[model samples]
Target: MIIFMQLRVNVTEFCIDFNCMKIPSSLLGFFNEIGAASRFVSRYFQEVVQPRYEVKQFIKQCFLIGYRSLPLIGITGFIMGLVLTMQLRPTLIAYGVVSKLPVMVSLAIVREIGPVISALIFAGKISSSMGAELGSMKVTEQIDAMEVSGTNPFKYLVVTRVLAATLMLPVLSVLSDAIGLYGSYLGVNIRDHTSLSLYFFEVFNTLKFGDVLPAIIKTFFFGFAIGIIGCYKGYNSSKGTEGVGRAANSAVVISSLMVFIIDLITVQITDVLGLN
Candidate 1:
């Protein structure tokens, strides 16, 4: 009987310990989210190739996502170049190599800063907007209603936005780079004298196919990341009104993180391929 009672106590203790053990809720939730996002991406690929392409919606999205974003991107790009040039001027002047300022600034902006910064800004504006728009539709049962009406909402919505972003980012990056170079020209003339033609000459002379191509190519991935993350977060959102805000915030955060990751990977690949 004593032995039986001791066994009962041990079982009770084990049950208590098991009950007291804490679950890794946050970690589990993160992994679950990752899985969900992966599945969403896979589904996108599958649906993208199917018939009944939404060509009209795709063009409309391109105009909205690309054309609407240009002014802000151009202004930011110009300021970035001007500020970067001004900041680097002193250092270059100290070394008496201030003439190399255009080359250095041009390479830095084209190879790294321009695409990444433009992408981040795009993410901040576009990703959050997509998330909020879709999340609102999700909460209001519009996405569901579309399904009931035999409309493929994901095709009309997610595919178009993603394609628009993917195609337009490279175009935006090109414009941003040009505007930035012009800003750098203005900056160079602030404390030094360099003609517009000379400034562009130095820029073009320094840039190569390797420098320009990889930079432009990566912007496509950056755009894809931003669009996909936004759509994924917004489409999967729950919790009604609160979910819209959460979706938008998460879209920006994740998309920004993705941009950095893709940039790093691209740099590594470029290094290996001797493109850098």
Candidate 2:
């Protein structure tokens, strides 16, 4: 009873002190923005789950957000693989494991680097685009108009973008992994002679379901996190044109951080599961 009363006193004193302290206008604005974003994200999921699936809009978003983003991801993935292989070659040669280059590079790319690099590219492109587009719509009060017209803006806008990112990222990752491996192949050939069959066979032999599944699974989470955070930032944007810029910038920053965080968690889980 005494301990409980002391705890209550501490809590009361803390609240009193907090209330008595002067909160900077900037800090208050920050809290308000965070609250708005939290509410928006919660509503976004709820709105997404309701009846009336927006299939056509979803597909359109998939094309705009996912299909359009592919070229960038592809180019980045290829360069990533090519560069990684080239950079690592000297070290492998030093170890007299130059012939093992294809296998090692392929496994490294597939297991960790490819998906991560691709996702970062996706985040830079898609998250910023989502934020700016939605933020602009918000600023123009188009989103409000939709709501007033009995259209669920969250369902129509947020769900489609998030779902598109979620669905297409896996497909993109598969392509990126394949292309990255090909780049590694070319990188291998630049300084050495290895047949396509030999290079790919080595890649496949070294790569198991263990390596593939965890990496693939983590990308889904990465995509979802990026999409949701972007949508949340945009949907909750305020202060007109300035807010749009801030939203876009914040979306990319937050989404990229979340991707790395998810990657770390994935590595831990994979290790615990003995998947790698």
Which candidate leads in TM-score? Answer: 1
Q: What's the C-alpha lDDT at position 31 in model 1?
A: 52
What's the TM for model 1?
0.92
lDDT on C-alpha atoms for all candidate structures: 0.92, 0.87
lDDT string for model 1 (1-276, tens) is: 334445545545555677566545574455556656767887889899997999999999999999999999999999999999999999998999998998999999999999999999999999999999999999999999999999899999999999999999999999999999899999999888978988899999999999999999999999999999999989989999899999999999989999999999999999999998
Tell me each candidate's TM-score.
Answer: 0.92, 0.89
What CA RMSD would you report for each candidate?
Answer: 8.5, 4.9
